[model samples]
Target: MLTRKQHELIRFIQTRLEESGVSPSFEEMKEALDLKSKSGVHRLISALEERGFIRRLPNRARALEVLKQPEDISAGKTAVRAAANSNTALTALKPALAAPREPANDVIELPLHGRIAAGVPIEALEGQATLPVPAALLGPGEHYALEVSGDSMIEAGILDGDFALIRRTNTARDGEIVVALVRGEEATLKYLRHEKGMVWLDPANSAYEPQIYRDSEVEVQGKLAGLLRRYH
Candidate 1:
């Protein structure tokens, strides 16, 4: 059986990957588990790796992939049998055991417009790069991508270093996450809230404070459409 801390760490990694298509950084894991340092997080990650529960990508910083949960091995041949038969009820017992199938269509590529801060607003720079994304993850619109550069939207599962797919638009609904340009000088990703003719850029993490501005001071750049994360 996995220890309590190990279980928590694995679950956190799995949940983050499922939500953002990326594993949490060492700093993120440390903060999430209330550890004192990244060393503690490193040790836990090492332990998990040694136990065959996870594997780190070669030469990549903070790159991790979940191999199998502890319970999956415990289930033994029953789990193997369940995974082989699509119609078996045992297939429902552990969804992760099944392998992922690739899409038949070609992946779509989008322009990567450098990085955007999810914390404090930063000047959005245009970069000459492109990112390949699953066709299903994109919506109908002119779309572009920006690499996230802050933890302000961590609670929303958008972590630093993940690529955010944005649907080009100038309008967004209240409480929807959007890329907002402040006075055409800086750009940020936050929950858009309009109150009494004032615009509020709300961060998902409580450590940061919300930024409030006059409606005329901000312009909606794009709405968050999807997210992409590379293992490396």
Candidate 2:
């Protein structure tokens, strides 16, 4: 059985990795959890590592890998369920709750294009399927989904195996996350930075370096609208 803090830390790490293809930095972990020092982050990471929940890659920065799947952790909730059940009898006298809500009609179906690299530009491929998403999340305009395939944008909460919803457009504002085709060769999902006659694809993870290109050599495919994740 894990302590409350341990469980919270594990969940935080899992969420961070899921949202961004990379593990959270120690400072990030500390700040998120409101820990007093970096030593607290180290101790928690060590505990999780010893329990086979995560692994630290050798000779790499911010290279922690999740060993235990989210499903496995969720399966350990028997105790929590039992505690909830214990309160059922006490609340039984309360009025019954309202009926279950029906599915909303605001769900929009979008094409799921094959994987796109978050770490580096890769050739864009035809979509393999379609997925349903909330229309409010996508806003207006033509949109599509692409599965993220790298940890380069982990710090930005875009993770491997996550679906990034992109609005189809040839233009994007500076500092926005966008799918950029470099030299008409491949498309990469990254934060766009514009300088004098130059465009830079910036990764959110420290382990990877930013890519610089001439403004004329890059084409904007789409701007990121939202993200989706399914834990199994």
Best by TM-score: 1
- Give the Å shift of residue 127 in candidate 1: 1.5
Locate the minimum summed-lDDT window of 10 residues in model 1.
Answer: 76-85
Residue pairs with clashing backbones, model 1: none
Best model per lDDT: 1
Q: Report residue 119 deviation for candidate 2 (angstroms).
A: 0.7
Tens digits of lDDT, candidate 1, 1-232 = 6888788898888766544444688889998889999898989999999998887855545556676777743242111112112331211111122232333133567888889999999986578998765544454578898999999987766778877878899998887788999988899999999888899999989899999999988999997865665543
Compute the lDDT of residue 67 as modeled in candidate 1: 66
Which regions of candidate 2 deviate over 4 angstroms? Answer: 1-104
Against the true structure, what is each candidate's TM-score? 0.57, 0.56
TM-score of 1: 0.57
Off by over 4 Å in 1: 1-104
